[model samples]
Target: MSVEGNPGRRLLDEDRLFSSDPSQRSVARRLYAEIRDLPIVSPHGHTDPRWFADNEAFENPAKLFVTPDHYVFRMLYSQGIPLESLGVARRDGGPVESDPRKVWRLLAENYGLFRGTPSRLWLDHALSEVFGVQERLSAANADAVYDQVQACLDKPEYRPRALFDRFKIEVIATTESPLDPLESHARVRDSDWDGRVITAYRPDPVVDPEYEDFTANLEQLAEMTGETTSGWKGYLAALQQRRGFFAEMGATSTDHGHPSAATADLDPAACQSLLDRALSGAITAEDAELFRAQMLTEMARMSLEDGLVMQIHPGSFRSHNQKLMAGFGRDMGADIPTRTDYVRALRPLLSRFGNEPGLDVILFTLDETSYSRELAPLAGHYPILKLGPAWWFYDSPEGMLRYRRSVTETAGFYNTVGFNDDTRAFLSIPARHDVARRIDCAYLAELVCDHRLDEDEALEVAVDLTYNLVKKAYRL
Candidate 1:
């Protein structure tokens, strides 16, 4: 059968994610059309800079879609598929599936696992919009669809930098560790591509005492910055110098994925003692947390000096599965959300830097219960604090609506930065941002229907949520 004749080849309705109400759907359509084509400002994400640096065509469909994204594999893993069978490499250099076609077939056979999920929406959008593959992924058409996507990826226009232009992305940021040399970022900057790929500083490895090789990472930091990291003062100086280097490389923000939102403002001597214990590898779990908390405050202070926007996304119990961690290392979707307390936890840092007009601190949470009860009120009050959009598990359409309805009443629209894709999958970037735009429009339409906002005002807010807000919030 021809591709167009296949039932699965049909694309989604134009009003797919909008409200079902006739009046609200009409308003949502109007709002979506107005800002649907605006340039994407992806201020924070985990896409590899190596793709842009090398300007190489993505190798295959499975490598492009299935392997890199934990969203794809986690669902598959949940259904008893081994990560190794899905082309996820093991730590001991053990053999895994090497054939891209086989991986694609496995994903296609289990595509129904993603039904009614945000992953399904993203995958469908990437297939239909990015690769122009009309057929839905299934075991029956897996080979054909894989061939079609591979053909597109083989084309020059489908290359990473070219797709950046095609997706109408104005700027994109990739996260990097302080220990990284950022050679790929330097390559992109020196190249003539003009794609505007930037980096964000993620200082987790060196800051958290519980991190693997934490002491060794500090030694590397000292060597990189020529600062003595044996002492607390020199340790901070080394981090500050690295932040400066990141700024020179066009980094405008810093990210922290600590276990909790704890912050501390300890005196110099107390901080030194914690640092000494951390360096000696004798710190208790409580002291390790204290060290992380103190580092949050220190990172905030460094942001004040260097003007790097600070972002805190806490409450993840990272690498929750010991077996997964032992085999696949980290970020294989073993991270799970825990109950987070932001009210008392952030008070120390907020009280110290809350009044600083120059500082910028964006807060994200895995705990939805805190939206109106804690996050919104805090952002509404603190001069330096802003609420990041629904993140991680909450980046879905329903998640976006829940976020706006929950937080906007107290914090207002301006206190929240616009959407960030926050994805490692390159193709999912545009699809994720598109989801945010549709949901934001649906929300504004509901407001207009209720006489809460004028149509003209809704249009303005739509553009801000789509474009202006991210650029301003991230200082891009």
Candidate 2:
């Protein structure tokens, strides 16, 4: 019998078909083959720009794969592996594992833990396709795979730009703080490399009062934009200035990672008073939230003015593991999904720009309950609104299917943006997109099988959902 840490064991057996029957699997496989090698269009993600800017060879398999990815670390953490052992950085300036080989061995020994998870699929694909590794990662093959991957890392063709080109990534967007100088992005542009790596303005550090060093961030914003961030008008202008700067760096979208979907549009005087209190550090937690809400509306208004796409991702109870958060800081995969209300919460911003034909506001949520109930209906009605794909915790095959099933009837295909891998794991980009394409084709195949749609139509819709829809939505 196959047990854990066996190199011969397959993570997914042939019996585990994505579709019910061999015929359906064959059909899905044909559909997947058509677009399997399509150039990746990563419109939004958390990939570090410095990687592309430097275009340096990756140090090792573990640092490239395990350390930076919360998905990998969180799973290890759940299995009682300390975050420090996983090389996760500590907030209290504590030490972490410096050896990449050790991290790789630890991750390899626990490979069985990712069974039945999307991580397994992604890892398997990377191992097979990227490293040419046929055997499963286990204690026996761990060092072998590590040495092979590390050897590849030392090669010139395995450098960041080389792999980016090899992966056929057409465009990748890296998220950046509004306070960022974008010097790395400038370096990328100046480089002879042709890879289109862009930046997206994430204004949370400056706009959200609860963010650490919020006051200092605002001061820096003022200095950067030459506007008085202490005043409402100047603050708004400073935000606009920074938005333009990001646009100059080829950013087409602005991302807001708010805690909730709450939005507001207070009058100028009221807004000014709120800004004053926030700037003075006199605002309560409630006021801070309200201010963030108003800023969402303000950001929409700015989006309309500048023609930048707006993405609002809300409803995460971030850093929920107080101990882990304290030890390893944010994005340790301790963020929990909560039930989010979009219809009522987004009313204030939608009321202002919902009917605007030119503006594009893409909405993403951690809450699945709101998909059909609120998000679909809202995106169905609003000219400016569109639904972002299943994100973060819900970016799985089931999650993708749920999104299509819940929202397709109301919002339909045109009202939704295409799949965004949204990963720090660079090698998983193609795998993630493949999963989405397969699930979409499978859904379309079901429609064909059920006689709800014809085979020819299903194929067309499959192509559109996988390729055309995302291009149109992201305006690429």
Q: Give the top-scoring candidate (lDDT).
A: 1
Count clashing residue pairs per candidate: 0, 0
TM-score of each: 0.99, 0.95
| Each prediction's whole-model lDDT (CA) | 0.94, 0.86
Screening candidate 2 with a backbone cut-off below 3 angstroms (N, C-alpha, C), the clashing residue pairs are none
What is the number of residue pairs that collide in model 1? Answer: 0
Please provide, for model 2 over 1-476, each residue's C-alpha lDDT reduced to its tens digit, 9 standing for 90 to 100: 22223576554443332588665676666666676677888999988889899988888898888988888888999989998887778888889988888899999999999987888888987887787677788887888889888888899998888988998889999999989999999999998988999999999999999887899998999999899998889999999999999999999999999999999989989988988887788999999999999999999999999989999999898899989877877888899988888888999998888899889999998999999999999989999998999998889888888999999999988898889998988888887887888888777767766777777777777777777877777777
lDDT of 2 at 396: 86
lDDT of 1: 0.94
Clashes, model 2: 0
Model 2, CA-based lDDT:
0.86
User: On residues 182-284, what C-alpha lDDT tens digit does candidate 1 reach at each position?
Assistant: 9999999999989999999999999999999999999999999999998988999999999999999999999999999999999999999999999999999
